[model samples]
Target: MRRTSLHDCPAPAKLNLFLHVNGRRADGYHLLQTVFQMVDHGDLLHFDLRADERIVRTTDVPGVPEQGDLIVRALLLLQAAYARRHGHPPQGIDVAIDKRLPMGGGLGGGSSDAATALMAANALWEAGFSREELMALALPLGADIPFFIFGQTAFAEGVGEALLPVEAPDCWYVVIEPGVAVPTAAIFCSEHLTRDTKPVRITDFSRHTMNRTDSTGFGKNDLQAVAVSLFPPVAQAIDWLSAHGDARMTGSGACVFCAFSSEAEADTVLQQVPGIWRAWKAKALMHHPLNTVLQVSAVIE
Candidate 1:
């Protein structure tokens, strides 16, 4: 029988080990240099085939309309592309998402969800697009979407589209959600935002250990200053975690994290987090979970 559904498909969240805004293009898109670090923990997606040609999401993500959810948008994009490629409309799919990550937390949770949905839909429908093709489709959805499609610890640039795989150390992290939603546009459009930090080579990051001993493991995230200034909770969370290690904001604002050498150590810190904020112990993932699923189908590795 043909494969009808893919179960337990993981959409892993990503952390920016360091984000630098190098400059802006004439198009007003910022040039960025950062490492996309995948954490093992994130939202999960399950797909079951539908008879007609209408994609639907069964789960309701708070503060997001189903019509505007990135995953839904991605599915529509994929169906359009698939129809053009195959000369027939693809089958509809029901998407059930088990969301473990927070929205607007700078964690790449939404982008990761879109990427995971795209991969699962591609296989179930036999759309036959390569990873390269899928990344092209995903990029317009979100700049961060392509990196999740790339499915590896990667170095990203060019508004976060340019991705080249890099080896980040296997480590544990204490991620603080801070219970606040920071708007990406506010941070990007901030008058105080720095738009010209010198770019660092990927090798510079690869050479250092992410563990506690390295004071300057990677360059600082340039977004942190703008984020902290706008969102007090972000600053509070960072300050709260800084007492333990080098805590930094992962993406634009709100969520912050620090690396630890072991799960026990990470868990120890997790327990000490303040009562108001939510925190978790997450391990760095070497690759996207869908990478393994794709390999099993012998589609892409």
Candidate 2:
């Protein structure tokens, strides 16, 4: 095995506070309003720097194309952007991703993976790309990619690209995955999907929000109904979870999460869930773990 410099990074999952399809754009993107909170549950990526200007993945991700890997694309985008800015290309690095998050679960795993690559490559290659510049590059990869680069709780809108940082309540999440893949594009393109929601203000969020206790005000995913209709397993998972606690789909479908005020509460629910379904008890993270790693790297420089 060729030894390489260690650049370990995290790829965290995101939960949708609420998803509203306000409308669709002429370009075919759905306009949306939602809050994105990072969770501790996600994949871990370990990067190794190489002298050659070639990008490679040491690990294979099931269901995702190797040639179209977002991590490689992110690194290439960073390399190109830096080369253009400084008038010189930098050395390349090989990435090894430990993909724990399930594909097509609407957990923002792919986007987070891409963000980790961008951040880690920036450090290893000595490319001084600002968060704003990285975010600009991330948007073309995926709308949720930018939020992971920003790496905080945020109010998201405009096809989930526009972001406004916000402070969210601390809570634990009981996330359940049904071992099924939900296609995001199919949900967005469904004719039955709700797309005429009135625009909401941030203040409106407070009025319609739910507590860990009430569970009533926690908003709905406008795409949930459409997703459930398409994927019955998603509805089954949500129904099973809702029986134990307040359950809602995180993004579009396939994964549903319930909120708990305490770890005990979350664990209790986790215990009762059937083993056939993949589940985890994780707390909402105020900051991404990679953020701390980036900070320490900055100090070393």
Candidate 3:
């Protein structure tokens, strides 16, 4: 059976339970550790396979040009990788993205979009790349890209590449997007950022202590200080949410979140949300939507 298009393929957003900057590597990339928790919410992309070699995106993704768009780049990279493996380029593809999540909100929206492209292209083209191969192709695009490919709640280290699956408590979140675009590079490069926070074992992040706002808990996102100092909206959002529960910035900034044990609790916070920010009640996903589609057992052996 031949398929013409793949639709409603979701590329969900992720929250950094806590991000810590240990030190700068010799290569200048920051070394860090964090837990990545996928949310049931995010962008959706569709693809229509083309017969000829003309890659196109059917819709405009604001702020990203066609050529530089990560989705387009993923398709091109997969084609190039296939050409290297075989003798010719694969068929072209048309991508359509229903943009939902906010960009620069530290939600991994773009990277998730890129991951979706790679997976769809692999299936649409019948390329048969292993999970490991797909992740390799993802890395050159973005650090978080590979994690989406890996597709599970994980404790990540080493610039967010290394991963160990973690059991994040089944919880819901009240995510607030402050409508400010954060510059991740600028925040990481800030002279005022914390770089030497003592590392904690992943086991220490057990469910019982995960909600603590103290120093030893999943207490802080290391970049939050820098992000708050630079983006007032992020700070404002955090403060507003804090009136209900402990809230903190995720990833590098521009969005803040607080966790609740149940959907109703999260929704209560959402109802009380101020008109200034966009708030969502999102559930944490145990795995990526594509987790079962790709067989990775072969790569393990």
Mind giving the per-residue lDDT tens digits that candidate 1 earns over 226-259? 8898889999999999998889998886799998
Give TM-scores for every candidate, taking all chains together and pairing residue i with residue i: 0.95, 0.93, 0.93
C-alpha lDDT values of all predictions: 0.87, 0.82, 0.85
Clashing pairs in 2: none
Tell me the TM-score of model 1: 0.95
Model 1 stretches astray by more than 4 angstroms: 210-216, 296-301
lDDT of 2 by residue, 51-135 (tens): 7878888887776776798888888888889889889887777778777898889899998999988887877776777887888
| Candidate order by decreasing TM-score | 1, 3, 2
Q: Any idea how many clashes model 3 has?
A: 0
Which regions of candidate 2 deviate over 4 angstroms? 1-4, 207-216, 296-301
Which of 2 and 3 is the better model by lDDT? 3
